[model samples]
Target: MHLEAFLYGGVSAVLAELASYPIDTCKIRLQVQGQVTDDALTAIKYRGTLHTLMSVCSEEGFFSLYNGFRFAALRQATYGTLRFGIFFSIKRMWNDRGGTDKNLPFLIALGTTAGVTASILTTPIDRMKVLSQSTAQTRKRKIVNTFKKTHSKGGISGLYQGIWPNAKRAAAVNGAEIPCYVFVKDFLTNTLGLEDNMLTQFYCAVTASAVGICISQPFDTAKTRIMQQKTHRTDIRVYEGFFDMCRLTISNEGRRALWKGAFPAWCRNGPWNIVFYLVMERFRKFDQWANQRDHSYF
Candidate 1:
């Protein structure tokens, strides 16, 4: 419910996102590659972060790097708004529900509530982002060229191809992230007696974001893999559910298989989330820009 926290949150996530785009692409690619006789990471040599970007550009095209960028940017901005907007508002409502921040278990509640809300509200947008990003650019099927192909797969339903697992990923991330962040932020402020100002909020938020990403990274691996697959992969049935994804990873590759593109995920999510939250907090407190300003479709 703190204004400073809200503002900082948005900034934190956005900065992190731009920085992590390459890693994000790598993780998405690795996950979608599906069953692995060899670990996707090891096979690729785990060479620095940009291997996926370089590989995609070499194999696909330059535009492939930006395949879903329009959708992703919009999604980030939109969810960023709603998440901070709603999270703070809701935290306000329930603030009265507890005694002190620690006594109230506000962190867990914040995580679950904000996560669920962001998951449900942004579900469609995120689905589109995944759909667009997952589909690589081919000679004939560049981004704009394949717009029809993307929707034509299953009409409207195709966009939400793996909605269930997406929800699980969302729920797990938000459920753990939101609450953990709040609690840690609280702990830092209340226990450590740090000033409940912007600096403190920023530090706490960064820590919370890191923790949340770590908790739900596995689900993220599974979720991205499921979405990034070609619609007609015969051998991809193994990645049907979230839990199924884990088992499939182990069976096909090894326990480390579940960690496909783990490095990029950490790279992409960890810092990006911090920026996202930071920027979001700024938007909420100081500046009053209307959400979704003149930008929707690419």
Candidate 2:
């Protein structure tokens, strides 16, 4: 059962990532936009989501919209697998212990645990994805070359450049998203007496996405800046730490700058969450049907 959940989660997440890669790319570009150079003349290539998409398409071509696609998929595979799989397993255990899935606190705690574990485990891939997507390096570099370059600079530690912020972002996102999703779904099913159908799941996912992005955007921005920083240059260190990054962003770019790529983040996370839940629900139904058929045949 755990294996099935892990496989389904990974496949669903990969599909979600593929469908939402362009939005994600735009978000990263936006987050790292002002950080590339302080000069106002060259600082603002990507003004917003639509502008960034159009600019990248016109200048770098449409395919460039998927610039770190492999790393994105890899991140989803490991991170998503651990998150969904662990959460599912924990929920099953709780249910077995006579605990209800409607327990909001339990759901939030489980989600946070799963999210932090997955984030720490997959930070290297997340870092690679951010660097590959950022505009700091103009040329499109292969993942192998990116890894090699990082390894050469700071050994293995280079691979986890912004792990602290990344993990915190993941914790915030999944903690909010998973609990909100569960709570919403339960409310619709139990209180509103809605059927466990596509519409209910879609609404739940949408609510979760909104909540998750709102809570996680600031940390996401910080993580992107940290990862995109040139680690070799101590003189050019843009952010000393997570708090420092937040302070610098607020002090320099104003408080709203903390949500630099909020629109793009919502664009990416909303559809991604919708696709993930829909696909995972389908997988669950398929598995149940298969098991029933096998048992009847036996």
Candidate 3:
């Protein structure tokens, strides 16, 4: 709960976000391609990770891979600030009511509240990020064309067409996923008597995120699906938007169709989380220094 911890969380979120862009790009393609009957990975064949990058470049264009990266950066900055600073502040305020570190329920509440608040605040930005990344074409590659097309649709709000779906997605992810992360960290540090060193901290951090990720990935898949549908929610099309996408998916492909991109998700989650935890360590240290200096904690 030190200032260093907050700084580390913020730094980690940004660094991890940049590091995870490739996996994210691939994930977007998998979902936007919309072939629920098949494994999303098999949709594209490339040599390796670098090959995937090359393919997206040669096929999708150079700027294709970095689609919505700016939006993602914004979301991470906002989410990280709220999650670490606001959530911790709220948690601490609640903790002042008197409770032992052994209270898993208390910690869960803190993580959930923080995740929910951050997700809601940043959902609009995240929607833009998703739309930008998934604006792929089975036909040709035109970066400017895609941008113009998307921008012309509903402007900024058009890009954020699926914020409601995202809210649902965030609830499961942040409500349960993030809380479980801190819970795991707490268990490892206290009940398990784990040392509070770099390795332990990193493990705890990544483990928390990874677990949260796995739990929330399906919802993420659903969210991406909803956003990339390219029609008004009120449209009478068989699949106008998120809820319609959900209905079509369930009726056509069954319930499991909703989780079409889990494989790529795991691939994305591993590296993304590794980078995230490592970066968070630095942020926490920075937060600590800034807070102590400001408060004269010395």
Instruction: Specify the highest-lDDT model's number.
Output: 2
User: TM-score: which is higher, 1 or 3?
Assistant: 3
Residue 279, candidate 1: alpha-carbon lDDT? 53
Q: Give the TM-score of candidate 2.
A: 0.93
Off by over 4 Å in 1: 1-16, 34-50, 53-64, 96-99, 103-106, 134-148, 196-199, 232-238, 281-298
Candidate 1 structure quality by residue, lDDT tens digits, 1-298 = 4543344545555565666665676677766554562233224432445777787778777767666666666566666555655565566555655444463455466666666666666655676566566546443334444445757775655566667776677767777666666677678877888875667667766676677676777777777766655555354343556787788678767786666676677677666766655554555544434543332100
Off by over 4 Å in 3: 1-8, 35-54, 61-63, 137-152, 155-160, 232-243, 289-298
Give the Cα error of residue 264 in candidate 1, in Å: 1.7
How many steric clashes does model 2 contain? Answer: 0
Model 3, range 1-298, lDDT digits (tens) per residue?
4454455556677888887787788777766553443343224354344556678898888767877787777778888767766555655555566654456676666766777777777766676677677755444424456456766876876666667677767666666645565566667878788875677766765676667666776678778876665554343242455666777777866676576566666677666766775555555555568667432111
Local lDDT at 175 for model 2:
89
Query: What 10-residue stretch in candidate 2 is worst by lDDT?
Result: 33-42
Name the runs in model 2 displaced over 4 angstroms: 36-42, 136-140, 293-298
Winning model by TM-score: 2
lDDT of 3 at 87: 55
Give one clash count per candidate, in the order shown.
35, 0, 11
